[model samples]
Target: MRNAHRVEQVRAAEAELMARLPEGALMQRAAAGLAATCARLLTRRRGRVYGSRVVVLAGSGDNGGDALYAGAVLARRGARVSAVLLAPERAHAGGLAALRAAHGQVVLDQEVGLADFSRADLVLDGIVGIGGRGGLRAEAVPYARAARRGTVVAVDVPSGVDADTGEVAGVALRADVTVCFGTYKPGLLIDPGAGYAGAVQLVGIGLDLPPADVSALQHPAVAELLPEPGAESDKYRRGVVGVAAGSATYPGAALLAVAGALHGGAGAVRYVGTAAEEVVRRFPETLVTEGGPAGAGRVQAWVVGPGGGEGARQALAEALASDVPVLVDADGLTELGRLGPGALAGRTAPTLLTPHTGEAARLLAGADGGAPPPADELAAARLATARRLAAAYRATVLLKGSTTVVADPGGAARVNPTGTSWLATAGSGDVLAGLAGSLLAAGLPVLDAASVAAYLHGLAGRHAASTPGAPVTALQVAAALPAVWRQVRASATADE
Candidate 1:
């Protein structure tokens, strides 16, 4: 698991660690790691660090101090280094003295900075740190835009990104790579901020932190969570997932949802909807029924919505009234807005809400009794959006997009880093809804089920779309699930 701590938590941890070490010891450790990373990148890009032209965009805080000290190290090694100070007067005194002693060129001219940024082998963006918000200052904006030729490395985070929420309010520096200190920040793992951050490298400074504010599950953790059938397990004992998706007009949604459910850990799938014939024709193993969820026999969990269309309201109500865990998606999510939190008032069982950006906006509007922000805005600030919805409904929310975020009412959140752009197909979300429902039926908690489902769904999408990925249909993603599941489980066991 990759843990992401908020800015305050990081500061507290750093302060505690700094107290135990000698003066300037922690900054030296950070600078050493930063310099080593720059050295490696320089060697890989230009074949050698010697004779390389490096420009450090030093700001007014520790971020600038780290970069200035790194510049001093690079200067001593025969690299031609220059420092462009956004706040020359407020720059770290120790770091500035060190760079000056090493003979690194320091200048205050923006034009010269731009020229160096354009020609240098590498540009270190230390103009802003995790605590910095909004966009780059006016003085640093041109330098960020001028780095068109060389690799731009950001220290801690890309300037302008909200470290805790992954929101980019204004113009932000885009980095080819971001070397983060201590641990991963939420902004590095979530979108908008994640999009600006091309690739991330973590440098440990030995700060003991608390439980993560956000986390991501890798293969081993997912493998342990996946339900495995025992010797005494039967089809019923394994799990039964009830799916109420599709209508007469859109039978493909039912086929796709059933496809995902069958491939998921559930032993059997009982589908009840208007698209019974279409589902039965494609998946003979599915126990099909034309009746509503009330008469759908026994099921460990229910997946409502998808292509429910006009029938969404009734199906969602039935599922919500049931004692079992229920996953609401697509049209069902739209209908859910009508009842607000009142619908889920006394329900004892867990309810999982899967909504894309648009649906999430509606959910927010319904709960808050006001117009919600646009889907693009919600997507840019994925963590906050998901957390808000989770808190509003008092249920688990799986916000699906470039970076899938699963947030529970209790404040625990997980970011899934497995998906590719190829997953933006028509019925892809339906597939995810069914897969997550299957995990819910298999006895996993709502948060775990949603996160693991997203992890597997993303991997399967990648497999369906070839190397580097290509366009693929939703059914292909569903078909790829078994192979991916086996690979994940096998990889986990091999590590043991």
Candidate 2:
């Protein structure tokens, strides 16, 4: 797991480092890494280092100090360095002095102006860091917005992005690459901010931080959660997943669900829905049941309501009552409020509720339930939303969106790191639900199953989209699962 400490936690860690280190040590370390990254990016773009124009958007905090120090390095390397101070009066004095000592030019924002921005080879966004709140203040906004496709590097978190919640309260500077110091912030992992973060490179400052107050899982965490097919394990021993989804109105939902479940390592898939014929036509392997989920013999888990038909309430209630775990999605989620808190509160079997924001808002705003909190910006509000749902419905809540957040009953959450915008196509959510249901059948806990499934689904979507205009159809995403599994399952050392 990659620890994404909250802003307060990062401050405490910085304080700890400051107490032990000599003056100027931490700043120098940060600046050195920043300068080195800029040099590489310059070399990659222009092929020559000396003549490049480097602009620093300086702020009042140590963040601007970091830029000034880095500017001094670039100046020493023969790259022309200029500083445009957003907070001219309060800019880090020591850093300004050092840059001047290294032959760096200081220019007011109005003096150099936005026209100079186009000619600049690179821009170092030192306008804000973890200490920043809201967007770039009134002055910094225009320059940040003008820097399109420029090789922009954020000092820590991007200027204007909320480090704690991944919320973009105001216009944010989008970074081509972000060189993070000490530790990763939650914003760098969650969406809106995550998307703005671009590619991230961590520069160790030797801060011995404890476990994150919040965190996001990387590849290794995904590997640990994946089930390995054993030599002694038969098909039956692996798991059998039952999917009760799709209706005459939405046959595509059933097909996508079956497609995803097939690649989820399920030994078999049993279908119980109005779309039975569609499942049989798409996949001969799916065993169609004439009755309902309970009449489908034995199943380790049930995936309910991709696109439910008539009398979905009774079928869903029956699935919930089964001794096995239950995954509720789509229509099932909308009606979950009817389970009325009492049913969920009393249920013994583990339950997973997958609801998007619109569904969540309705479910959360019960008449006796109180007004719903403002919908979170994205996954930033996900942890809070999931916690609320888990507490209210008494089930593990997987809030699906740009960044899928899987929160356990205890409020511990994992923000998915692998999802893509290309997954916005139709029937993708059904495929995701089926994939998660299969993991539950294979004996993983709700949080693990939902998170791992999301990771796989995202990777598969990316892999499929590699084909031009491929669009990553639901079947394409499912087919790419084996490749995703292989890439993650490679038994390489961490260094590799």
Candidate 3:
């Protein structure tokens, strides 16, 4: 797992580590890593770092100090380095002295800084640190607009991004690569801020930290969570997932959901919906049942909603009333939103809610009986939005969009890292809902089930779109799951 710490957590850990180390040791360690990464980029772009033009945009804090000190290191290696001081008097005194000693040029003029930034072989962004929120300062705004031919590397977290929440309120500098110290920040792993961060590199400064509230599952971590049948395992022993989805108008929804369930490691799928005929035609292996979830016989878990249309409310209620875990998605989310958290208040089993931003707005509005907030606004604050919905409903939530964030009511969260823009297709969500519900039936915890399903769903989407890189149908994505599952397990085993 790739863990991410919040800004406050990072600060506390940094302070504790600094107390035991020499005054400048920690900064030096960070600077050394920053310089090394820049050096490698310089080498890759050109032949060498010697005689290359390097520009440092230095602000007022230690973020600037780290950049300035790194510039000094590059200057000593025969690179032509210039430090642009946005706050001349407030810049780190030690860093300034070090740069001057190494013969690095200091530009106090804004025009000169812009010119240097536009043509330099490399530019280091230190305009704002993790604590600097809102947006870029007036003096630093020009660099964001200025066209740059070289690579831009950000120090720690990117400027103007909330390191704790990944929210970018206004304009922020986009970096080709970000070298974060100690550990990854939450902002660096989520979107809005993550979109600005092209690629991320973790440079350990050795700060002893506590458990991270947010994390991204790697292949090995996901491989461990996946279910495998033992020799004594029978069809019932593995697990059975009951899917209640689709209607007369959207019969394809049921077929897609059942298709995903079949490949989700569930030993069997019991489908109950109006689209039973269509579902059986496509996947005859499914055990078709009449009416609602209450009469669906035995099932380890229930997946409600999808293209449920008019029957969603009853199906959701029945599934929630069951003693087993339940995953609610699509139309089911709409009904749950209308009923508010009280609808799920009596349930003892785990409940997982999957909502896109628009559906998320409805869910949030339902909690307070107010007008739904704009979908775009909710999407911009993905982490907080997911956590809020989870707390309100007292369930695990998988907020799907550009970033798929799974948040449990207790505060732990996981961000899916394998998503692609190609996943925004029709019926894609239906497939995801079934896959996650199947995992829940297979006995993964609510959080793990949601997180693992998202990870695999994203990888499957990527694989389906890989061949010609064109748009793919929902069925193609579901078909790609088995191959991707094998790939994930094989890669993990090889690493072991």
Best by TM-score: 3
TM-score (C-alpha, index-matched) for candidate 3: 0.99
Model 3 CA deviation exceeding 4 Å by range: none
Q: How far is candidate 2 from the true structure (C-alpha RMSD, Å)?
A: 2.5
| Maximum-lDDT candidate | 3
Error of 2 at 289 (Å): 3.4
**Candidate 3's residue-wise lDDT over 108-201, tens digit each?**
9999999999999999998898888898988998998999999999999888888888999988999999999998989998998998888999
As for candidate 2, its clashing pairs are: none
Please give the CA lDDT of all the candidate structures. 0.92, 0.83, 0.94
Candidate 2 lDDT tens digits, 68-134: 9999999989988888888899999989998998898898855465656656888888999887888
Candidate 2 minimal-lDDT segment of 10 residues: 372-381
Clashing pairs in 3: none
TM-score of each: 0.98, 0.92, 0.99
Candidate 1 regions off by >4 Å? none
Please provide, for model 1 over 326-380, each residue's C-alpha lDDT reduced to its tens digit, 9 standing for 90 to 100.
9999999999887787788898999999999999999988898889679998998
